[model samples]
Target chain A: MNPTTLKLCLMAVLSLVGIGLYGLMICRNLIKMVIVLQILVKAAALGLILAGQMSSQINLGQSLGITVIVADTIVAVVGMALAVQVQRRLGTLDVDALSSLRG
Target chain B: MLEAILFALPILTALLAGIQAIRTRSLIRSALWLAGVSASIAVLFYMLGAHQVAVIELSVGAGLVTVLFVFAIGIAGAEIQPQRPIVPKTLAWVLILVAILLLAGFALPFATTVQHSTEPETTSVFWQQRGLDVIVQVVLIFCGVLGLLGVLAEEKAPLDQPMVDEIAAERERDLRNLEYQSSQSMVSSQQGQTR
Candidate 1:
């Protein structure tokens, strides 16, 4: 990747990270939070790819990036499932209501 | 020229999708936007020559994650009120613009060169150096299934007499409806025979 391309990729990562942080801070919905986490995961993956490209360790970077992607999918699936169950039992998807862990 | 455009395409797509994902109020639409981000990232990976990682991202990110989000939204059955997304949206854009200006002012002066591999094949490293990561990935997926099962496992609800009666009555009505339909079909068949 050229310098411009690299800079663009970095800029993309920063934008995604910023957007994801905004969602995480402002969104009250649990499912949306999980979706925002996915955005953050993509940013991390992109960052890893950029790292690989810069160091010419493409194989190592790709391997790590794939690991990140796998872990992210698992987390998203589990998180969403839990969110669904929370809505079912608590009767609300609001994070404030879920703040208490009283059984 | 083409290389620059190709490199920028996925980045542009991801930035747009990220903004949309953060700003959308509807859970389903937000999930779709996340999928768009994932697909664009996969495109970036492919363009960077990481074919294996790209395929994995395409399958798990774009495919499974989106489906899972939609299913969760379906089950949750909560209407996400359109909150004030403008604040976060504008803040995100402003921060991005600032970061771009800072990068241009500070980082562009060096013009550091990057060295990319000509062969993007990573299967060797995946099995050799990152075997443990793969194992961890499998464990994480298995744990996710277990976690889902744990969450969805419902306790037996105590059945009240009225609730039981209501259920039985509904079942009886359904049975009566089925019987009526079957009898009508049988009678129609006999009429056809007579004809």
Candidate 2:
């Protein structure tokens, strides 16, 4: 990739990270939180690939991206499972309602 | 022009999808929009010459994650009752804009300084060089599976005897109340018939 392309890609990654953080700050729903997390991780993975491309170690970048994908999948699965349990027990998915730790 | 178009298309799609994912009211729609974001990212990855990562992102990030989100929504609930955001919208936007600008300021100079390589190495580095990371990732995946099982497991009653006894007693009282109500209704019907 050219320097200009790299700059553009980096900008996109930053924009994505910003959007994800914004969503995390405002969204109260647990599942929505997970969705935002997924977005954030995707941008990170893109950044990893970009780093690899820049460093002339595209293979290393791709490998790291794959590792990130596997870990992210596990996170989503576990997050969803926990969200289901929270909804079942607390009767609401709002993170604010979870302020009281009482079962 | 074509190269510019290729980069612009995916980036625009990703930005728009991400914004919609956060803004949409329906949880399912939000998840779908997230999938859209993932797909666009995959496109960007492919354009960046990371074809393998792009495929995985399409399959896992766009496909599996979206399915998981939808399934979770199906179980938990689909509609999020509209509520005020935790942070006020104006303040949140200002903070986000400031953060993005700060990050870009820090990142842009470093990005410009890096010279692109003519010869790019591919998957050999992954298989030959990063064995430790692969093993650790495997271990992490196993732990995640175990954690999922633990979270989803049926809750056993508390070990405390008093608490168990109290729950049993409460259930019994509820059953008795239900029986009494049914009997009282039956008695009232009998009296009306007699009249």
Where model 1 places Cα greater than 4 Å from the true spot, the runs are B82-111, B116-121, B150-152, B155-195
* Poorest lDDT segment (10 consecutive residues) of candidate 2 chain B: B150-159
TM-scores for every predicted model: 0.76, 0.83
- Which candidate should be chosen as best, given lDDT against the real structure? 2
**What 10-residue stretch in candidate 2 chain A is worst by lDDT?**
A51-60
Tens-place lDDT per residue, model 2, A1-103, is 5678788899899989999989998999998999999999988999999888788767788999999999888888888887887887679999987886675
lDDT of each residue in B1-195, candidate 1, tens digit only: 678788888888888988888787778888898889999999988988778889989998999888878877877863687554434767766765775577556644443677544653477788877789989988998988986774455632357567899999999999999999999999999999999
lDDT of 1 by residue, A1-103 (tens): 5777777777777777777877776787888888989898888898888778777887888889988988898888788777877786678777877877685
The candidate that achieves the highest DockQ relative to the unseen native structure:
2
lDDT of 2 by residue, B1-195 (tens): 568668989999999999999999999999999999999999998988899999999998889788878877887899998888999989999999999899888778867656556643555667668777789789878977875674565654245578888889999999999999999999999999999
- Candidate lDDT (C-alpha), each: 0.80, 0.86
Candidate 1 residue pairs in clash (backbone atoms < 3 Å): none
B98 Cα displacement, candidate 2 (Å): 2.5
- lDDT of candidate 1 at residue A27, scale 0 to 100: 81
